[model samples]
Target: MSVNESNPRQLKLLAAVRERGAATVEELAQLLDVTLQTVRRDVQRLAEAGLLARFHGGVRVPGSTTENIAHGQREALNAEGKSRIARAVAGEVPNGCSLILNVGTTAEAIARALLRHSGLRVITNNLNVAGILAANAQCEVIVAGGTVRSRDRAVVGETAVDFMRQFRVDIAVVGCSGIEADGTVRDFDLREVKVAQAILAQGREVWLAADASKFNRLAMVQLAELSRFDRLFTDAPPPAPFPDLLERAQVRCVVAGADATGDPTP
Candidate 1:
C-alpha cells in the first residue's frame, strides 16, 4: 500500500479509527487484513500528517485541540453526521417523556429533531436547546440556572449541577469532545463536565450522541464512561476494541444510515 494520504489503506485506516473511536495495532491489522507492521507504518504516516493520533498501541481520529473548539467551528465540523445521529437518537425517545440534554452542537441537533414531538419536558443546560424546544408550545423547556458561558451558550456551575439533581428523567442525551478507546467520555471544561455528570445521573436511560470527528480527541475532563450510556448513536461504526468494549458494557451502537463506505443502513 502506498503510505500516503490518498492511499486506500490509509484512508480506510482513518475511517475505521473514526468509526470505532480508537483501535489498537492488532485490531487495525485484523480489520484491514494487513500485517501489523503495515498498520503501524500507516498510523505513523497519518500521525505525522496530523490526520490521526498514535497512542501506545493504537491510532484514533485526532482531537481538534487541547482547548474547546469554538461553537461555530464545531457546528461546521460534521454537520451531516450530527444530523444523522440526532435523528437516530430521536427515534428512540418517545413523546411526553422527560429528558435532560447537555450542551454541545450534537445536543442542539437532538433538540431540533425533537421539535415536532409533543409533551416533552426538556431540562437543558444549553440555551440553544432551550430556545429551540421553547418554540414548541407542547414541550416544556426548563433551562438550568447557572453562569452562562458566552462562547457556546452553555450554562455551567454549581447551580446547574444542583438543578440537575432535582428530577430523574426518562432519558439523557449528551455529547462529548472525545471518546477514549477504553470507553471513557471526555470534555474540555470541568464546569460543563459537572453538569453533564449530573444530567447523566438523573436519567434512567442515557444516550450519547457524537459525530465521527469526536473519536480520538483528547479532552481535559472525563465526563463518564461509555458503560453509563444505554446506547450510542453515531453516523458510523466505532473501531475494533470499541465493538468488543461496547458489547461487554452492554451499550448498543446505533448507526444512523449508510456510512461513507456505503455500509448498509441500520
Candidate 2:
C-alpha cells in the first residue's frame, strides 16, 4: 500500500501513542475498531518514517515532550527481528572467543545471544550489557568506563576510548544510527560516533548488526565509510542505490529479513 493509503491511520496511531505513551496492536485494534493487521500496517508505516518505533506487541511514542526515550520501550520493537540477528551473530562465534559489542539497541540484542555461549570474553562500554552478562559464569565481561548518557543509556567519553584500545577482538558487532547510499555509517551524536570508531579499530572483523530502518538515513556524524566494514548484517534489503553502493565498496551485505523465516515484504 502507498503512504497515502496508510497516512490517516498512521496519524491516528501516532496520536494514540502520544496520549497513552505506548499502545499494543490489540489495544489499538480495540480503540480503532479495526483488525489487528490494520493496526500493524499503520505501525509499520510510521516506523519506516522514523516517527515511531515498532515494538514487539506495540508501538512507543517517539521522543517526548517531558523526556527522552529509554531502552525498555525499544526492546519491544522487532523483538523477533533482533533475536534473529542475535542468533546469526552468535552462530559466528566459537567456544572461546573475544568480541566487542557497541552500545546500540541492536547490539543489545546481540549481547543477549552471547549469553548462551560458554567460555567467552566480551568487551563493551554498555553498562546494561555488562550487567546482563555478569550472571553468566562461563563468560567474561569487560566494561569500558566513561561518562554515561542517561538519555541514550550508554557510556561514552575519552576514558571509554582509552579502555577499548587495550584489547583486540575476533569480531566487533556495532550499530548504525543511519546508513547512506554512499555507504557512510552515521550516528546522531559526535561522542557516540567517536566511541564507535574506537570499537571498530580494536577488531579485525567488523560486523555491523542493524535492522532495515538504518539504511538511507544519515546520522549527524559519519564515522566510517562502508569499505571499512567486512560484513553488513541487516534485517532487510536496503532501498535503491545503497545495495549497489555497498557491493561496489566490496562490503559483504548480508540481508536477513525482519521476518527471516519468510521472504522480504513487498
Candidate 3:
C-alpha cells in the first residue's frame, strides 16, 4: 500500500511510532491489528518517503531535523506540565520589558501565558509564538526573517541568527529537545541551535522551559549548558548529576506544581 494513501492503518502506524518513539514490526502489527507482512510494506513505504527510519527489527520515528513531528504533536506531548511551567515563567516576567523567545512547543505555551501582560516587546523566531502573542495589542511581537521550515513553521538559518543580534532583552525564553547529564541543553537542528545561541547572547537573563521528559531524551546539537540559563522551569526535578550541576552553576530550578529550589510562588 502507498504511504501517502491516508488510510486508517497507515495513519495509525504513524501515530504509534510517534507515541513510543520507536516500534518493532511485531509491535506495530499487534498495535495496528494488521498482518506482519502488511506492517512491513507500510514501513517500507514510509521509510522511503523519509517519514520514519528502518532498523533490523523495527521502524522508528525520525527525531532528526527533517523528520521531527509536527508542532501540534509536540504541544500534546506534555500539555499540563508545559502550562504550569508557562505560568511560573509568566510570573517572572514583568509588565513592561523586552523579551526574546525561541522556537519550541514549550515556548509556545509561554506565549499563551504572556497574553495578559501589557507593555512587553517580544522578539521571536517561532511563527507560532508570533501569532499567539499578536493578539495582545499591548505586546509588541517582532518576528525574525529567515528560512521558514514548512514542516514546523520554525524560522532558522543565518538570517534568523543575525536578526536576533540586534537586541539585548530583559529575559529570554527558550526550550530544547534534551537535557544532558553534563547540564547541556540540546536540540536536533544545528541551524535552530545557532539562532537559540544568538537569542541567549542578547538577553540579560535567560530562562529555559522544558518538561521532565527532556531529561531522558537526546539530541544531536548542543544549545548551551544549563549554566547559561538564570532559571529553568520544568515539571520535575532532574535526575542524577544534573541536580548537583545546577546547584554548582547557581541556576534556579523551578519544578511545576511542586516546591523546589526555585519556586516562583509568593
Candidate 4:
C-alpha cells in the first residue's frame, strides 16, 4: 500500500518497530491501544509494501541493502522526526549564507523551514526542494543540471556532480538512505552518491540531517563517513555506540526538541 493509504495507526506502528528493531503482535497491539486483529492487518500491509518484514508473530524493518522503500513511503516515515530535524538545522543557519541541499524528504522539509530566512542562496539537486524554496522571495534558488530521477524528482549523474563542483558553499545539508553501525553513511543509488560526495566537497561545513530511523539501517552504496560531517541533526538521542562514535569523530550531535544545545566542539 502507498503511504497515502496507510492510516495513522500504521505509521505509528512502523515508528514503534523502528525504535525497537522488532515488535510482536501483542506488543504492537498494546502500544497502539488497538486490537490484535487490527495490529496484524497493519503489519501485513506494511510488510507487503516492503516497509517491514513479517515473521511468525512479529515484524521488523526490512534488511535490504540493494533496494530502498518507495519514495512516497519514505516521505511519510518518521515525518514528525524529520520536521524537528529540519527546524534544528534551520536554527543553525544564519540569515545570509550559501548551502547545497541534496536529495531526500528531510532535505525538502529543511527547504520549507528555511523559507523565512533572508539573504540566502540555496543550491539543490532535488526539484522538490527548489520549488519549496522558490516561494521565499529573499532566497535565491539554483537548480543543478543533470538527469532527473522521476521517482523522487532528484537530479543525479555525473553532470550533477560537475555542477555542484562549480561553487563552494557555507554548508551542505545532506540526507542519506541509511547510516550503518560502522559509521558509514549510505544510499541506494551510486549516481546520487557521487553527487552527494561532490556537494560535501563543495561545502565549508557539512551538516547531516537524518531522523533516528536511519541509524543502523543498511543501504548498498557508501556515500560518506559520519566523521565527514560537522554536525548531525536528529529527533532523538542516537542508540548505543553512536554517542561515543560522534564524540571521537568530533561531530556535534544535536537532538532536536531536547536539552542538548549541540554547541560546536572546542
Model 2 misplaced stretches (Cα beyond 4 Å):
1-70, 257-266
Query: What residue runs in model 1 are displaced by over 4 Å at the alpha carbon?
Result: 1-65, 258-265
What TM-scores do the predictions have? 0.76, 0.73, 0.74, 0.84
- Summing lDDT over every window of 10 consecutive residues in candidate 2, give the lowest-scoring window: 257-266
When 1 and 2 are scored with TM-score, the better candidate is: 1
Model 3 lDDT on a 0 to 1 scale:
0.80
User: By TM-score, how accurate is candidate 4?
Assistant: 0.84
Expressed as tens digits, the lDDT of each residue in 65-138 for candidate 3 is 43345566566655666777888888888999999989988898889989999999999999999999999999
Clashing pairs in 2: 54-77, 55-77, 56-76
For candidate 4, write residues 1-266 as lDDT tens digits.
Answer: 43335554675687778768899999999999999999998887778667789989999878778988877877876676677778788888999999999999999989988888999999999999999999999999999999999999999999999999999999999999888778999999999999999999999999998877677777899999999999998877777678888999999998886332322222
List lDDT for all candidates, in order.
0.81, 0.73, 0.80, 0.86
Model 1, span 1-266: residue lDDT tens: 32222344665677777777789999999999999998888887667656578889987766764677568756755566777777777777888899999899999988998888898999999999998888899999889899999999999999999999999999988999888777788998899999999998899999888766566556778999888999888777676667888899999888887332222146
Residue 190 CA displacement from its true place in model 3, Å: 1.0
Report the Cα lDDT for residue 250, model 2.
80
lDDT of 2 by residue, 71-181 (tens): 554565455656666766676777798898878777877777777789899999888788778878999998888899886568898898888988899888798766766
Which of candidates 1 and 3 reaches a greater TM-score? 1
Q: Is candidate 3 or candidate 4 better by TM-score?
A: 4
Query: By TM-score, who's the top model here?
Result: 4
Sort all candidates by TM-score, best to worst: 4, 1, 3, 2
Residue 182 Cα positional deviation in candidate 3, in Å, after optimal superposition? 2.0
